[model samples]
Target: MRDLEAGLVDAATGHAIVATDADGVVVVFSRGAEILLGYPCDEVLGSHVARLFDEAELGSVLAAGDLDTDAPARREWTLRGRDGVPVPAEVVVTRRPGVGGVPAGHLFVATDLTERRQAEQLQDELIGKLGHDLRSPLTSVLGYAQLLDDDTLTDEQRGYVNAIERNGRRLLHLINELQTGTGRSRSAWRGRRIRRR
Candidate 1:
């Protein structure tokens, strides 16, 4: 039996805890486990952890040599919940050290990353907006500089103009990449719509 008070304290810290046998049968499933995996103890206990996995991504996940074997294993895997929704989860599995410092049953902890996806989307939007706002001035500066010729300008003026053109062109390159995420020459630009959003 689990110590409910201690388990609750652990749950408050955000790690979902479980214990399983070597063959993968779940033994102890805590509330944190319930929230993270989205299957209650009654349903998950005595069940294989593999049941929580998406069958398709499993082979590659195992082949990656990514399992932690240090009395406990730690890994990240995209797991499917009872609702059949795929979620990114961080997992840690450790064996309880026994008399000879050998493992008893496996102990597992999982953390769900629902908030992380939101943060990444917000970051991408900010970068895309910053890139879009800087594009117009850079285009104008490059346009004016390209119109100048060496015969009409002093050496220092030519050098300054060249620097301006180079920086503007670089800025344009970065903005295009941010907007479309692909490199396309001006000839290709006419037919393709940039994926700015």
Candidate 2:
């Protein structure tokens, strides 16, 4: 059983898995946790898990109060590292049972969100650029189509001009939708960042 547990811990690449007694004392600190937070198991195993985060940051986790054994809770927060660096992380906590099937400890699995946030920012930037490039030509096309209505033209020419105006408006609408979607995504990102502060 010990060997199986050890293997599980070893396999937790890029994921921080920690176990703490019901009293909040750390008992299992996996290698992935060390890599993520820069603390070795020997140093953290006997310490309280709260020591890894700021006093204020615990609000999201503690708000749930005492959890029933087997019940899992999740939250996102900025975790402070041994080096005093803050890492944006999402943690899932599950209550573990002891010999008598009573709640004895808690297990935590945390994933770092730094890379994911960076990727989102990059995607937003790219989308913004694409929207800008598309709108410029669309604006010109719409303007020209609108001006054509003021000129004298044959019936067939009027029909062609109307088609141009209609398609131009449609293209402009599509671009606006793209920009609106990107703006909403950026707003959500900002909201999450503000909550973490």
lDDT of 1 by residue, 60-120 (tens): 7568644435645667767787898987877776765556765556676778877877786
lDDT per residue as tens, model 2, 18-111: 8889898999998889999998789998899898776786864477573453667777768778899998898888988788887788888999
Listing every candidate in turn, what is its Cα RMSD in Å to the true structure after a full C-alpha superposition?
8.1, 7.5
Model 2, position 195: C-alpha lDDT score: 20
Which regions of candidate 1 are displaced past 4 Å?
1-5, 8-10, 59-68, 71-73, 98-102, 129-133, 173-197
Compared to the true structure, candidate 1 yields what TM-score?
0.70
Q: How much lDDT does each candidate structure score?
A: 0.71, 0.80
Q: Return the TM-score for candidate 2, rounded to 2 decimals.
A: 0.79
Q: Could you tell me how far off, in angstroms, the CA of residue 122 lies in candidate 1 after the best superposition?
A: 3.3
Runs in model 2 deviating more than 4 A are 66-69, 154-156, 182-197
Least accurate stretch of 10 residues (summed lDDT) in model 2? 188-197
Q: How does each model score on TM-score?
A: 0.70, 0.79
